[model samples]
Target chain A: MHEMALMGDILDIIMKDAESKGIKQFSRIDLIVGELSNAMPDALTMAFEIYKEQNAQLFTKDASLHIQFEEAISECIFCKTVYKPDFKISICPSCHMPSGKLISGETFQVLSYEGE
Target chain B: MEVKLNTNVLTNNNVAADYNRDLFHKTKTLVINVMSSPGAGKTTLLEETIKKLSKQYRIGVIEGDLATEKDADRIRQLGAKAVQINTHGGCHLDARMVVATLPEFDFEEIDILFIENVGNLVCPSGYDLGQNHKVAVLSVPEGNDKIPKYPQMFMRTELVLLNKVDLLPYLDFDVETAKEDLKGINPESTLLPLSAKTQEGMDSWYSWIDEAYQACLKQ
Candidate 1:
């Protein structure tokens, strides 16, 4: 899955940044994953565990991944009704139109990491 | 020590994509990234497209596959320059992969460049290859549930080429329902039904490309 590639990129970013900050080993990683971000959090956790196991030298024995799941929220442009969207393109319940513009739940980023 | 790094996981890919976008804009090349599920007739559509448009414009193609030069060879058979990028097992083509292949084509000599992305409905929708437009091909055989099931692909693409309309009479694919579902997911997207085999309704696709090429020159 692409989650492996996304996890690889996450590790690459942290490793490069951690080196510059004089961090020797990572203890934890915090990621903000949105429901509509195209990345599954469970898959990301599996990938992180695999990377942690393979690159034991860089991570602490108990190094873990913490994902903050963001719910997908959209606001209808026609009615201004806020609701949870099942998909990126959602129909507003109030307006019954496909005018809901996503206001949140598309974020996929590393919020922070603990090391050294 | 806790490092506060608010960074995107796809930052590197986005940076490379921006770089590729700059190059495409500078060269005035109308780049179209065509994506679809496996066996959705992407190559056949490209073959017909090249045949129709090559007389007036110099076209180049970048074919992406898990592991094959077959698509590139097909484009080459049409007498246009084509380069193949095999992802091995990678689900989709990233921006850096496209950057790696940029050296093979002289953009100045190419008026239009079509990037045929790996035939996957899921992974390819997430990555940006710095194309002027992203188009998805959905065949009638894929059924009506595809538009709703793969909203991300339809949401990101500006155009959806509904291929194999020639087979529509034999299948239960509802064109009206497909259009309605697409609208619910992405109202801005337009779906054009056509048969690459029969060459029916291909004129609209060519006109869209002509308009896109004209728009590219203005920018």
Candidate 2:
């Protein structure tokens, strides 16, 4: 939802700052939500639809939303193991000890998008 | 002619988060976004933390919940600057929400800012609120199996607080296994166990805050 809200805020600024031809149609919206970030794509799409209907003039109110999901993967420093776990485990499969370092999925990203 | 516009949806919020992060860094204040399941002792820990650490570091809290000024009101009574950001029905606090409340406290005077996120282990972990650290609290009363149940929340956390330890004597929890699973998923994460009610072993938490605060000073 942060990403979605952030996008909304950005769209507002972009529309205000660059008043080129306004919006016609929109295309793909690639989102890199880590396997861990519990964001619902369908819910986001629904919210967007409502928002677009309300402010259709500023955006491509009829554009289709396409989402690309990114999974969260962590590296085990102790055994140097790299794997993706079910969104329910926090430990290395091989080593049972807690780690001294953890790197985020860095999976959070908006790969790209295009207007219709 | 049809125009094809390539734009990133999250571009604006990322910009704002970057801005918020820079602001935190400039002020040399350690911002910790705290999250957990509802009834997971966020208020208990925040209250205890303010009482103990306020003398050494100026602490401020940005409390997020579905509805209520109650938490914010409680923090204010502790003599720390507190601001309430009600999500209405949202699951967590995003960078935008935190930025909205930035004007409430003097970041310059604060050594640490505790953002008590809405009580949910899942959604909040995915959103970055421009903080130095993300701390997760898991109360023992909630059960030991929470580690495997909510992996992402524990995996991304900088530190995990195993609260309500005082109730351990009466529960069927395997503290070791929970810690093991937690370590398995997030090995480098700091684990602190204590009871907010009994205040048992809370000194470690205070020390951890001090360390995080000092690191902020260096930045």
Give DockQ per model, in order: 0.74, 0.36
Candidate with maximal TM-score: 1
lDDT of 1 by residue, B105-151 (tens): 99999999999999999989999889999999999999999999988
TM-score of chain B of each: 0.99, 0.95
DockQ of 1: 0.74
Query: What's the CA error at residue A23 for candidate 1, in Å?
Result: 1.2
Regions more than 4 Å wrong, model 1 = none
Which one is best on DockQ? 1
TM-score per candidate for chain A alone: 0.92, 0.64
| lDDT winner | 1
Whole-model Cα lDDT of every candidate shown, in order: 0.93, 0.75
Worst 10 residues of 1 chain B by lDDT: B147-156
Docking class of 1: medium
